[model samples]
Target: MKVGLIGFGKAGKAVANVILQSNEYSLEWVLRQSTILEHRHVPEFLGIDSKEPGLIFSTSSIEIEELLSKHPVDIIIDFSSSNGIYSYGKAAASRKIIIISAISHYDEDEKQFLSELSSKTIVFWSPNISLGVNYLMFAAKLLKKIAPWVDIEIIEEHFKGKPGVSGTAIKLAKELDLEETEISSIRAGGIVSKHEIIFGFPYQTVRLIHEAISREAFGNGVLFVADNLADKKEGFYTFEDLLSPYFTN
Candidate 1:
């Protein structure tokens, strides 16, 4: 499979490295606005030889369309902000290319735009793509069934530079049919990522936590979703879908 990457941020770079190390997928193109003035040397930043074949680098949608026309990819992995979703989503949908997006904090307009785009092509969207985080969502469902009377709350902490509440916490709350206000967001230190689900009962308390020690955890989950969704039909999917097998077992 051939793959295109959008955004060269921390998560994008980590996902690209994982793709580069795999023989199953070819890293074809990378789209980013930050490299428009970098003399077309995007591969250099990715530690790849500049002369590598089938690797097109561009900073705009026009260039991306031209490159896709000449060298089409099977999928495009997006780690960009919500603002770029409509443009990138429409571009990929027009080409019938699958999109795996890990972007978070989308406004209502952006969310609706993406939902419409999914009608044209497969869109696998997940804010928190870590398997453990998705598994936490699965666990939340079970808890809701087994302990319906318990009060639940989510606490998420991330690096100081991170913005908005943790998507994982929001997802967990949504899955459990709880209010978003039940989540607490913390930003401090250099914490990679940590989420705790507290279940309080009249007599005892239970807690479930998942801590991301490194970016590789997220990268692995992205690759896993990409590989699983590569052959899937055109539709919308999520990381929780990837955890179905575990729950059935």
Candidate 2:
């Protein structure tokens, strides 16, 4: 499978490294919003050994359709901002390319746009794509179902300077019947990722925790989504939708 990446930030670089190391996927091109590091080969820049072109470019360097036409890819893994999809989504869907977005958050309009695109091609979006985090969410939901009266709260910790509350925590809050205000967030140091769901019972408490020690966790998630959705039919799929089948009891 040929792949195109849509962001070049720290996390994006880590994801690119994962693709370079994967024998099943070829990194074809990367598009970033900034002009820095424009026109660099992804493998040479990351010091990986692959013959794939994997070139990098600024979004402004070329039109979105032209870029897709010149370097076609089977999938476009997006670690870019929410609006980044606005640039290439329709164009890629028109070409029947699958999209997996790990963008942290998207408003209602963006959700609608993605839903519409799914009619043409597979569209997979996850607020938090770390497989472990998604697993944590599923486990928490199960515990809640088993004991609906138990009180649940979510806690998330990330590196400092995060601009908003953790979207995963917010989703957890919704699942466990808590408000966004009830989800706690700690932004300090260089914490890769941490989420804990505390279920308080009358006699005791159960704590379910997932901590990501590296950004490569998300890269593995990219691979998981790729493997599962490779031959899936055109539709809008959530991380939970794809991950749920593997959670068979």
Q: Rate the local accuracy (lDDT) of all candidates.
A: 0.78, 0.90
The TM-score measured for candidate 1 stands at 0.89
lDDT of 2: 0.90
TM-score of each: 0.89, 0.97
The all-Cα superposition gives candidate 2 an RMSD in Å to the true structure of 1.0
Candidate 1 — which residues are off by over 4 angstroms?
36-56, 60-62
Q: Give the number of the best model, judged by TM-score.
A: 2
Q: Per-residue alpha-carbon lDDT of model 1 for 115-168, expressed as tens digits?
A: 888888988888888778778777878987998988988999999989878877
* Top-lDDT candidate index: 2
List runs of model 2 lying over 4 Å from the truth: none
lDDT (Cα, 0-100) at 30 in candidate 1 = 72
Output the TM-score of candidate 2.
0.97
